[model samples]
Target: MSTSETTTMTAPNPAAARIPKKTVKDFKFIKEIGSGSYSTVFLAIESGTNRELAIKAVSKELVTRTKKISQVFREKDILALLTDCSYAVKLYCTFQDERTLYFGLTYCPNGDLLQYITDAGHLEEEVVRFYAAEIIEALEQLHNRHIVHRDLKPENILLTDDMHIQLTDFGSGVIMDNNDSPPQSNGTKNVDEEKKPIKRTNSFVGTAQFVAPEILKRGAIHVGSDLWSLGCIIYQMTTGKHLFRGHHEYDIYNAVARVSYKLPDDFPPLITDLVQNLVRLEPSERLGSEETGGMEKLKSHAFFSQFSYDTKWGNLLNQRSPLETKVKLSSRPKLSNDELETMSSGFDDRVEARLIGLRMASDAPNGIDAIVTGSSNISLSNETSSLHETDNQSTLSDQSSTKSMYNSPSSNSSFNNNAPVIARRLQMPDHALSLSEQASKNVYHKFVQNNLIIKQGILDKKKGLFAKRRMFLITEGPAIFYVDPDAMELKGTISWTADLRIEQKDMKTFLIHVPGRTYYLTDPDQDANTWCKSLISIHYRYYNTDPNRKLSTTTSYSSSSSSSAMQTIVPVTEL
Candidate 1:
């Protein structure tokens, strides 16, 4: 272990699950190892085995706790399956004791690659070659199993006790089977209709520091994404600087696509050549040149001419680094103390505001009520309070959709009374339908669960006080949904617009009458008040008065399409 750095393994409180009385609970409990959004890890000792290991205990209701529930399952399932693989963490066992799920695994006493980088400003060319070789070899093993460890960054690449590299987290890894859909490991449906040529996902769920250009560009990707990420790590090691550390997605993509970065003037030509190719915006033309060509070609490169894999890198890092990366980068984006404090304050305000709104919208009149009064005549009352509460808790706890909703300023809204009301209102532009949530969850009170559908031409805007509404056509993986977009406008007036389709039906659409209050109504019997909390009670912009531009342009909708300007929420895990 690195200078008194202790390690241990743990399981859920055995007593909670009636652990056998003689299981021998004598292992010493150490401090926490890692704390992430869904889990916390601790290092503990195994009294029986007299060995140390890392124990990860996750919430049993990880589904409710995590928005992307499949990801949690993916992590546990992949880790447990790959315990036999030398390049991956060795999972000891998986067990549950009531409210928590546990994983006992071998501990990495050397910490992660990030710790190594933190101790060294920049790796020597020879050192970089060694780590790079190990990482690619590890990735190859994972690919052989048809797994793509999508979230690859320094933090996830840990060094085992003997200094060999081990890939730790597989939360984002998707088992893309070219054959029939890999039997849905978790609760994730086959999305059979969504089956197509395995390609890169434009919508990302990984850290920006190591994301590929294809992901940034809203383009298709495959195993090649892994190579691109590896290139970023290579650059970080050599330069001791982040490759694409930008705030916005555009800046990140631009850097990856255009190589808008500066490197040391003496950077070896062979090293530069490899970096460029690995960071190539196109996957087919990425590094290694051929399937088995990665390590072979990399070995032959002139940059590694001084290296010998035999005894060359056995314990070079154990010898220690000269300086840390944070010290080497003088040009790193520096935030002043005052600036950090101000930014923190702003973030807290936004979070508080959002929490208040979410609590309200989810309260009295939210999804449950939306169904009862609108399309479905199902009633939610005393007899179904228990079911309603449980469903409400599930929706609030689900991490996928609402995280983006809370983070986004443009999408979330509240009503404002002082705002100028639209005086001469015409039909709302058909394009206003863009604001609706693309992933529609229809909570049928009678069914008392979530209905997953991509609703199309959903009733959006009510043409009048009581009229057929403007609806948006939304698509996800392989389904389509119709969403109604009736938002409040100037004071209490409903900005009325009619899609030619809704105009034909002429059905009376519903609207909340308060001037600037966006309340989630409970689907109660006609007697009770349903509004929970107020997310935003505001009128959507009526329309930009421009006759030259066509309103609601005929944009083709496809579930497979990746142009997600409107919210297509996906929860990103550290793994």
Candidate 2:
């Protein structure tokens, strides 16, 4: 281990779970290894055999707050299912505590491919092929299982003790079960239709830079999408930078949407051809798509055959990787004061503002919302308690039509006369309304949670009564507020995640603060008042149960799980 980096493994705490009493005391904590927003990876030792392994400890509360319940379940299932695949990571056992969940996994001592790439800046041709071949093999295994690995960056590719590659991180993966109707050769049909050559998904997920064109266009993706990401990784391996890097995340999205990127001029022709075949704009044009001979074309590519067409492909692992590809550990230097300040400042507010505007305008299917107000006719509400009982009577309804319920004057007139008198005349454009309704539908079923539409007040006093009527859905997360609802005129969008602070500024008004933005909302409309209170409630629930809040590190012991002990034993103890 590097001198500056400490590896930690926690000793099992008996009181953590209700399973076997003995399970908690089985593994001994050694040192802290790595940590993420919601989980920590530990380098632990099994007491029975004294064998070291890597275990991931994730907080249940954090997972729930992040709305990654499906991901958590999918990752666990994929790891367990792909244990036999040599190119995939192995999972031993899983156990959870009242505060955290644990997954015992094989330790990759040499670290990930990303670090090696950073150290070398770029890899040689032979080295890229070796890694690329292994990755292709890994993709083959995943594809055969009908699983699409939506995220495929170098960080998820770990190196074994011998420096061989093993794929990890299945959190963004999708498993194709019988429930989904496969897309037909001509096109996709409803879910009830018969199976076809491909499965189409509309989920907007995956790392921004590496996302495929199909994903950005229609939220539809197939197994071949992995090939597109693979092509990007191959390009990065040879050039040491992303093929589709833009000025910002949204720029990257636009680039992916158009497949507008150029490979290095110095790139080898054979390798270049291979990459081009994989990264075609249309899914069907990609090398591994059903129309393109799938894995056969990839395996038959000239680049892989450069080693020797007659040689058994798996035997390529026997050939030692280039000496330069080996990882060299170095101590991390302390950050300077200026660097510290920059790091602490989070994101640049100006850049974030622009990015948010672009995202809100382009991301949703309906494009952008149009807020058209007639004459100043209605007053805003200032007191939550003053909301009429009639406002509470209207329950949450589906947004199936383009016409917004906010424009109805009957709901807006109940506001206090002393409150700001903003015109209640609101008109949503057909495109924007349709998209918002679609977003609402997707959120309702995808999250498996009921979405409550509540009126939220705009806090900006400068905007006055002309501010757009904002929608709030506690379960949907990340409240998206429009500075201007019109698409063509002066307009922008500001969004806040569930993790931010939401404070009740007054009886009917609330304030939301994220890193670079602050939003205010006040509504005397019964529905708006109810929504504001709901926002306050949701904020407190998340804040009070902060997963990162320091918990009792000292564990209480009972007996350990015999099964857990037996499962963690490994042949190689260290990398």
Candidate 3:
């Protein structure tokens, strides 16, 4: 039997039905690997099977508040439906608690395609073809079941440990009734349906950059909608950038509506043809659409000429991946500082402040008093500062009395009074701090010397193709410092100037343009707007404060046949 026929005949995995009996206690959670608006995915081990699984824990309260209960259940149903599909994530079982619902799925340790592509820069055409074929096959199975994946992007495509592709995240998928006709090899459809210009839908779905033009125009989603997204993913894989990009969602929508884009100068013509064909403005005209030749037409494209669907494609999972040498299994999983802080509730903030104060005192130019009375505009906390001040004062007083007793001729009479303080000091022995603690001291001093911290938090810093988790500290000097949170090491610093510009890329992402480089950062808490506004405000404050600053300008003269001349100079400022 053909692959599609075989997949269609396969029975749903019986394990999906055995739900609700199990509980969270049945599994041992390792650590959280990813999180979304309402769900968090953890690397866990199922006690019953003793196998590694990705357990997705969904917040019941958040889902209800957002009215996404239907989407949650729909995803569960879709995952169950796809249980037997090898190209898709397998659902082992599901269970729930009072506060959260959970899904036990096959763990793909290689991470998602977006991260993979990012780490690898741009994949070779051959590598892209290998992964694309697997995605196409997965889509074939979904379409055969009369399901359209409304949201298909690189983030939704995960890589198995062995590097095979597994299409996941079916929350936006729509399942048509059995009465609806599936896409056929030959171009054929109902006469009345074919006559319509476009199908309409009131609700919008999918990522802004990857959504098809028809979707942006309020057109209903179909199998063709996914093909357009696949094309965008292919472009990103080949070029390492989005095909349609903008600073805002509406800008991206405008670009998609106009079909405005330019390919890289070195882009291969054959790949260009395939991408253009797949992203055609009319959904019905797109390659692989039911009105076209469906999956057969897409497979026949020159870009995937090396693989034969009948034999070679079926065994892709067994073959060695092109990225075999590049892909390395992590020896150990280190929890990020964000994750650590979330898991460690017993971590005392006051204790941390005291530790930091001790370290600061050791490095301060004027001893403990310098740190206690430093000219810092930023305060860690009101309670922390007060506690630190009181502790420092008490220690200093004890030391002063001890010194007086030792140096004075009336020392014998004061001995009893100073003995307890000396004994207390002796009891608190001095020892070397750990590397992380020492590094924290250095970081703290570095911030203090630069006018102290204004705002500090964990954010993802985009470096080349990888997004690294960094502890970022913004200082009163209008400087930005990103540090390795785990190691407490300073990575880089960006000092603000009149030429500096801060741009908000989206709700969570922003860009900092310096003189020579632009830093891309993403906040997990969706606080990019606040970050941008604060940075701009600080920049203006500094600019206005500088009395020695000059209004640097350039002269531009109008060239006209008439002897009249016009000079224009635009003043540069923070945006």
TM-score each candidate. Answer: 0.47, 0.52, 0.57
* Ranking according to lDDT, highest score first: 3, 2, 1
Instruction: Tell me the lDDT of model 3 at 175.
Output: 54
Put down candidate 1 lDDT per residue, 217-327, tens digits, no spaces.
544435677887888899888887787744233345567667566666787788888787777766656765344264456456566566654433324444333233223
Which stretch of 10 consecutive residues in model 2 shows the poorest summed lDDT? 370-379
C-alpha lDDT of candidate 1 relative to the true structure: 0.44
Better structure of 1 and 3 per lDDT: 3
- The TM-score obtained by model 2 is 0.52
Off by over 4 Å in 1: 1-28, 61-63, 178-203, 217-221, 247-250, 257-262, 289-295, 309-575
lDDT of 2: 0.52
In angstroms, the error of model 1 at 55 is: 0.7
* Residue-pair clash count for candidate 1: 57
Task: Give the higher-lDDT candidate: 1 or 2.
Answer: 2
Candidate 1 similarity to native, TM-score = 0.47
Compared with the true structure, what per-residue lDDT tens digits does model 3 show for residues 326-392? Answer: 6775564555546534342211344335433543354333565433222222211111100011211
